[model samples]
Target: MTDSAAEARPPSIDSSRPHPARRYNYWLGGKDHFAADRESGDQIAAVMPSIRTAALANRAFLGRAARHIALQGVRQFLDIGTGIPAPGNTHEIVQAVDPRARIVYVDNDPLVLTHARALMSGTPGTITYLDADLRDPAAILDHKDLHALLDLTEPVGLLLVAVLHFVRDDEDPDGVVATLLDRLPAGSWVAASHATWEHTPAEVVAELQKSNRDGRFVPRDGDRFRALFDSRVQIAEPGVVSVADWHNDDPGRAPAADVMCNALVGRKR
Candidate 1:
């Protein structure tokens, strides 16, 4: 294949084992998932039933948080671990408030890159797709494509939606978060949704651990999850509550802790 032909070809995705991005795509009912993702998702769901609700709530939190930031005059976004985009996407929510808002999506998933248009095709501002891993903050921070659409000097909304659990402790996730946050200027924002077993039943936690080893999502408990945020940022209201409870005005949803996922926002100082 010619170099140009290879560049035009869809990104190569590993279908042998379930990946977190693909499996998460499956949970969101998107079409980019593979059979391995489907099978692994079902297996995990069978063991831990709340996974579906957790996923939905996670997405809801992203929407609300994006709107919150956009209203605060944030016009640039660095959305990482941007799984197969489905609904209420970061750009969609942000652009509705300020059409000139720029968004840069970063993800290691080749499938997400292949299907990156879900986050692209904005009306006013620009959108760029980066085939990079969050594990390497240096690469993402210095990426040429992302820098074009985002201004490090200006406040940008850093979206860590449903990501971060993938960073094992040996990788120093806290340090990674700090590095990313430090690069952005003051008045920047960060919104994150993380998978946790804080209040999950002990039996469910055991099963989820097995699934994490076999599948994709890395489940953390409360303390470990919150440690990923840097101390420089001031946390937003509603604190580290579950996605369902973060700024919740509804009465029907389960209590935040009951869902076992924590969602929160912080502003750079």
Candidate 2:
């Protein structure tokens, strides 16, 4: 890692407590998680058996959205709440479309920061990582590394896949997204997905919501999820739908009820 990246590293990682990124990595069948993460993931999986499928579908949505945006001629991307290094990452997908494509990845997790080098291993100077939180859009937008790699004046792809639910309602998640979108120039696109309980059993939803009293995961319905984009963008064709169904033609795609995540791509007006 570079000096700046090392400086951004947290003092130490707390493996004793479960983190969203690590737990999600565990669910995605990655080996970068600890016992705490595994146990937490297992507990959730027991309740939501298709969570692993959901994770994979969400990952697929990210790649498809990145390619969709890149194909639209948007070469610059800002991906916040980036989880651990995974295949088909934003840089990899978009850079494949155009070698000159530039990307900035942001994540507050210390573990993700530790793997920043892997995430940024692409065309020289085409990708960078920031140790920042989505709740604090200014910190991410104002970061020198992000500005160095991405030009806000150009049409950029802003990715928020499967990350917004972690931000509680009290934190003003909509304002956070609106703030980020407000800074990007017109024609910029935002591809986002959020966990939902719309299709989940009422008893299960109640259990999940009660268990999440600490405000860790806040699942929204279709209408509430759609409201996050505000009036600054135009929802693309198909609007918000299951992550597995977005631009996916696989006959084996999991049902929306099983995936329980909604995804959408919108262009800033």
RMSD of every candidate to native, in Å, equals: 4.1, 3.9
User: Per-prediction count of colliding residue pairs?
Assistant: 0, 0
User: Which of the numbered candidates is closest to the native, going by highest lDDT?
Assistant: 2
Name the regions of candidate 2 deviating beyond 4 angstroms.
1-11
- Please provide, for model 1 over 1-269, each residue's C-alpha lDDT reduced to its tens digit, 9 standing for 90 to 100: 12234345464756766888888777777766667788889998898676777788888889999999998999899999887778787888998998788888888878787667544654434788898999999899999888777889999999998888788777878888988998999999999988777677788778767766633457676666666774777888867778898887888886655567888898998
- Which ten contiguous residues of candidate 2 have the minimum total lDDT? 1-10
What's the true lDDT of residue 198 in model 2? 87
Q: By TM-score, how accurate is candidate 2? A: 0.94
Model 1 — which ten-residue stretch has the worst lDDT?
1-10
Q: Write the per-residue lDDT of candidate 2 for residues 104-183, one digit (tens) a residue.
A: 88888888987887656645698888988999998888999988888888999999999999999899988998899999
Best by TM-score: 2
**Model 1 misplaced regions, further than 4 Å:** 1-11, 117-125, 214-217
Candidate 2 local lDDT, residue 45: 81
TM-score of each: 0.91, 0.94
RMSD of model 1, in Å?
Answer: 4.1
Quote model 1's TM-score. Answer: 0.91
Over the full model, what C-alpha lDDT does candidate 2 score relative to the true structure?
Answer: 0.88
